[model samples]
Target: MRLRNCLYHFAPYGFHATWHHLATTHHIPGRIESNPSSLVRALDELETARALMLPRAVAFAAQRRLQKREGRRVPAALHPWDSWGCHDIAYCPDPQKHPAEPLPVVVDRVLGACAAGTDRAGRCLVCGREDWDLWRVCQNCGVASGGRGAHH
Candidate 1:
């Protein structure tokens, strides 16, 4: 169903809005009722992002469990859960600047770009632009990237 592209997952932003944004950015249609199979693009992106997040999530969970056992009330990783489902989440400040690439590829590029120890300093996590402002929104892509660390 067309509504499959519009879902409300347990993410920080409603996944429906995120899906619509991504769909529109990627030139995907809002109504797939005509063919029905066109809905796969949005779902594929979501699934890929989930696949990328799963390992980190599991490790984070294990770390949290260890911390609990160690009597650490707060997560030492700093807002570890704040980024839940942030991959491809609704942070597109400038639709035109959002990459036309897939979500996993964008994430990988951002990871590599930020690997030089620039956690929130140089590039836009989503768009790979070097136009971050005060709140870390990319002037190029308009993504409030939550910083490279959070975005990744």
Candidate 2:
């Protein structure tokens, strides 16, 4: 789960390690990694492994919790962070300074301060349109005759 979170949060950097760990630890029986279908099938069922395994972990923990409660302990209700420790995944980089990096659109807008004349038109890597006042269609597609897509 820590591996999955690392992969999910850090993306490209941690993916290799996460993949290696997953491939080694949770390898499916007689499956080939080269097969996209096999990979897809395994990826699709990752939650099933969690569904099966987590309950058992929780149950075992629950027993400890129960005993602890009886032993004058407060029952830990399994806070979401309990599984992964104190690692709260947060967007570390300031998007305003490094807007080139791909980001979650919602948070990206906030971090990039989208309203401070950070026009999507100018930031369009495909098109180069600085003056948002004059152009409705992007420069890449219109004036520049470039074929970059809408979001590219």
- Taking the tens digit of each residue's C-alpha lDDT, what string does model 1 give over 1-60? 443423444221234345545567455654556544545766666667656656655676
How high is each candidate's TM-score?
0.67, 0.26
lDDT of each: 0.51, 0.33
Which pairs of residues have clashing backbones in candidate 2?
none
Task: Compose the digit string of candidate 2's lDDT tens values, residues 1-152.
Answer: 34355445332112343244335434533446444454444354443333333443455567766787788665543222223311211111221222222223222332233235444444432233355322233333221111112113
- Residue 91 of model 1, lDDT score: 47
Give the Cα error of residue 18 in candidate 1, in Å. 3.2
- After the best TM-score superposition of candidate 2, give how far the Cα of residue 111 lies from its true spot, in angstroms: 43
Model 2: residues >4 Å from true position, as ranges? 1-18, 21-42, 72-152
